[model samples]
Target: MTPTQATAARRSKISPERAQELYAAVLDELREHGYEALTMEGVAARACCGKSTLYRQWRTKPQLVAAALRAHRRGTLAAVDTGTLAGDLREAARIAAGTSGRDTRLTQALGLAVLSDEELQAALREALVEPELAAFGAMVQRAADRGEIAAGHPALEFLPAQLMGVLRIRPVLEGRYADAAYMERFVDASVLPALGLAPAP
Candidate 1:
């Protein structure tokens, strides 16, 4: 379609506020039914919009859900500066444990599907993984600058894997979501020792 036609089409449909409301429905559907089982019709029904509206906005379920994911993306760990690497890591662990349980479930739900679906994988990376990775990298770099860790410390290098691994696995292992207290314990018992540092005094 022509640019004017596209603009007209978009203008004729839902408001941005309305679209935001619909995106919530999309995510809820994804959480409830998973990616493979989610349908455009289901999202529309939940959003109380016409299926044609969604189809007009996004030609396929993947595109619509990708948009929803992007719309819902937020800063996962954008403001975590605790003055010391150990302090920061402990704080990070706490944040991850509290916030990541649902994300872990979502990732598990999308597991093998993400591997085979390029669009879905890209959406997942952009919406979920990249922000947290950037935050973790910045946290580590700040720690190095502050002399909390060696520039080439092994723990610094492996920190992301360690934290993310525990976040993903804890639910499976114990049939319980990791919580702040559990994360603090993990930091004290494991992360601090790996970094060759004692817990904060």
Candidate 2:
């Protein structure tokens, strides 16, 4: 194993419950203090763990944040399968809406730090963006296979952007986070129409 991997493997293992607590603490610290002001010392204190443990486990702040995000979103979108594209999309929208407020706050918290820090940017994309995209792509592919929409439909490419855009912009435009009802309506009114599919009944 590489030295980094070797070191990581040698570090004491954290139980799943303990890990969740630590991740929660990390996100709580991030939301309250923002990325620039967040520190490993603060997280360790909040999580009630040694600073050395945090460093040993995650090695960097970006990595810890990424891990926390991944853990938070684990199995969320991937579990959506309703046997229809419209149903799946609506389900995904519902899931996105559930966390919209907290996630929006988290994104706002990170703000320009994400732009300036390459590691943070890449980590965030890997943790938050890529998995959801993959899940959405899988749902679309299944829909195509079921002949719900044309495989070459132009709207497929914009689906993720559309859903994510509404989630991110609703707060800015309406001063409110997108809720499940709003997201479902968006899927019915905007997304389904664009894909030449009818709204879910």
lDDT of 1 by residue, 1-201 (tens): 964366347745778898898888988998888888999899999989899988887666766776676566443576888888888888888778766675677667665778899977766675566777898888888978888788788667777888888877888899887788888888899989988989975
lDDT of 2 at 196: 89
**Candidate 1 Cα errors over 4 Å, as ranges:** 1-20, 51-75
Evaluate all candidate structures by whole-model CA lDDT and list the values in order: 0.78, 0.88
Kindly list the per-residue Cα lDDT of model 2 for residues 1-201, writing each as its tens digit.
864365347444878788899989999999999999999999999998899998888888998888887777634899999999999999999999988887888889887998999999977787688988999999989998998888889989999999999999999999999999999999999999998888888
User: What is the total number of backbone clashes in candidate 2?
Assistant: 0
Query: 134, model 2: CA deviation in Å?
Result: 0.7
Query: Which segments of candidate 2 are over 4 A away from where they belong?
Result: 1-12
For residue 140, model 1's alpha carbon misses the true position, in angstroms, by 1.1
Give the candidate number with the greatest TM-score. Answer: 2
